[model samples]
Target: MENSPSVKSVAYPYGLMLAIYSILVLVLIYLMNIDQENWVIGTVNSLVTIVLYILALRTFKKKNGGFMKLKEALKVGLAIAAISGIISAVYAYIHYSFVYPEFLDMMYEKSYLDITERNMPQAQTDQALELSKMTLSPLFFATTTLILNLFFGFLISLIVGLIMKRENPAYQ
Candidate 1:
């Protein structure tokens, strides 16, 4: 146990790798002029996160002598997710604030169009747009993104941990 690497040590590197991969996807979307709201992009990102979680957990388990408690797996997975989320949030803030200041406006226009397409009454449309505007801020974006990542990360890690957990024989 003392010879095994700590969870943080294993998680940090994988977390950074995930963050970089996520950022690269974002950059690709931006450069390709693709809609940022694309569902496919989100799906791909989610898949990548799952894969990274598996890799990180597996690496930790192997290093720990092929033994990993559910709690230990959870801890490593959550740590990786937290690290990636924090970095991604910061990047998003920067991207929206300076790299592409018009992103908020673009999202607002898209929301307005969507609301209008619903054929809602003028009053209802206005109310919806108002709510959308409130949520379009950079800080809000970062906060929600970080929260969602942690939420999904927790869910995925719970399942993966349940499947992959192995008790140390000596402890038994």
Candidate 2:
């Protein structure tokens, strides 16, 4: 525990990585004309996120004599993702609600079309569309984005921390 760096020590790298990732997302949204409907773009962005997490953990290990406890690694990883999630949630709400208010409607229309293509009854299609709309609502989108971020971050941290964990022989 004494060997591990303080959480604040890694703050700069964690925050800078998240900020860059967020900006990259915004850039992709504008340049590639991407929206949440296309899961591929988001998946690509997540690759960068994974790299950032690994780097953060590696940096922490380097600073703390090339060792970090699992608990502390989880703290760093989750904290980075959670705070990043909050930042992203705010951005998502503002972008969808203000910058491109039509985005959500576009998603609904696309989803409706996709669902109707299944050849379901009109009543069933309507019900499905309504449910889709609820799921894609601004509030739900932001909230789920935050939760998913934390959830995935937790998983990544556990795996990475396990791989990176090393005990101080002297302390042991």
Candidate 3:
């Protein structure tokens, strides 16, 4: 195969999906004002992201003479995911900090209510609310998102790579 696939080739599809998912999430939070119960958005994003990853891997395989080793697939998949995750983290930081400052307050209030409902001591409730506020900051949120994204992305890559790996019969 003369035209071997580069990491960039895989990153392209991942980046495209990340962009679409980012826009959809921002629109959901901004224009649609659908800021809460993000499970809906998360679910959609996770499923689509996986599909995009699979497509990218298959494309890479095709370009590599229609075979991919397990190790090669794992590296490519993880790189694609890391790039996608960094892009997402940066966008999320900007979106939440500048685009929707009100989102922080809204989340804080919601958390406060949930905490209060527990009927814990007022001091504990205050502490919980304080902790939430501290953690909800843009920097912290971005850091957490980055960590979670990488964790899940690596996990997904393991499964996807195992399924996608194909040995070249001629190699043996």
Candidate 4:
């Protein structure tokens, strides 16, 4: 009988693909001069993530003779998420710190405008901008990116795993 593929073996390649795809999208957005806070970009990224998770789970199921446990699916999904998150975090750090130092300033300016447009009092606006500055730092960005990826990844994995789980007859 052929050996079943390991989670790492299946996940690493998919994770790398996801990271590359995400970076490419970011580059495309930047090249096209789209706002960093665009909802369309977020929607696209979310859809891509869901599709990749489904594809990865399908690949694993196919390799394992069309059977996959919930645990196996969860493991594969989380592994892919972690690997991709780490790579993306590193890239975010470098991109924010060096490749586009002005990006933070732009975000800050946008935030200020948004707050003022809401007719926020001066004190509240000052406080909000202060909070925004901290949140927009490179370290904060990298950490938040990793955390949000893991969070959304887990949610996607849980739902997908529940839907796709098929126990091996021999093990039942």
Instruction: List candidate 2 stretches off by more than 4 Å.
Output: 1-3, 35-43, 119-123
The deviation in Å at residue 98 for candidate 4 is 1.1
Name the lDDT of candidate 2: 0.79
In candidate 1, which residue pairs get closer than 3 Å at backbone N, Cα or C atoms, i.e. clash?
none
lDDT per residue, candidate 4, 51-121, as tens digits? 99999999999999999888889899889989989998988888889888798888889888887888888
Q: Residue 30's C-alpha lDDT in candidate 4? A: 68
| Candidate 3 residue 56 C-alpha distance from true site, Å | 0.7
The C-alpha lDDT values of all candidates are: 0.86, 0.79, 0.77, 0.87
lDDT tens digits, residue span 32-151, model 1:
989877999888887888998999989998998898888888898888889989999998888778877787998899898999899998999889999999899888988986898788
Q: Cα lDDT for residue 86, model 4?
A: 93
The C-alpha RMSD of each candidate to the native structure, in angstroms, is: 2.0, 2.5, 2.6, 2.5
- Best candidate according to TM-score: 1
- What are the models' TM-scores? 0.89, 0.84, 0.84, 0.88
Off by over 4 Å in 3: 1-4, 38-40, 169-172
- Locate the minimum summed-lDDT window of 10 residues in model 2: 11-20
Error of 1 at 52 (Å): 0.9
**Which has the higher TM-score value, candidate number 1 or candidate number 4?**
1
User: Could you give candidate 3's per-residue lDDT for residues 10-99 as a string of tens digits?
Assistant: 776776576567657766668877755689776887788788778877888888888888777777777776776777778778878998
The TM-score of candidate 1 is 0.89
- In TM-score terms, candidate 4 sits at 0.88
Clashes (N, CA, C under 3 Å) per candidate: 0, 0, 0, 0
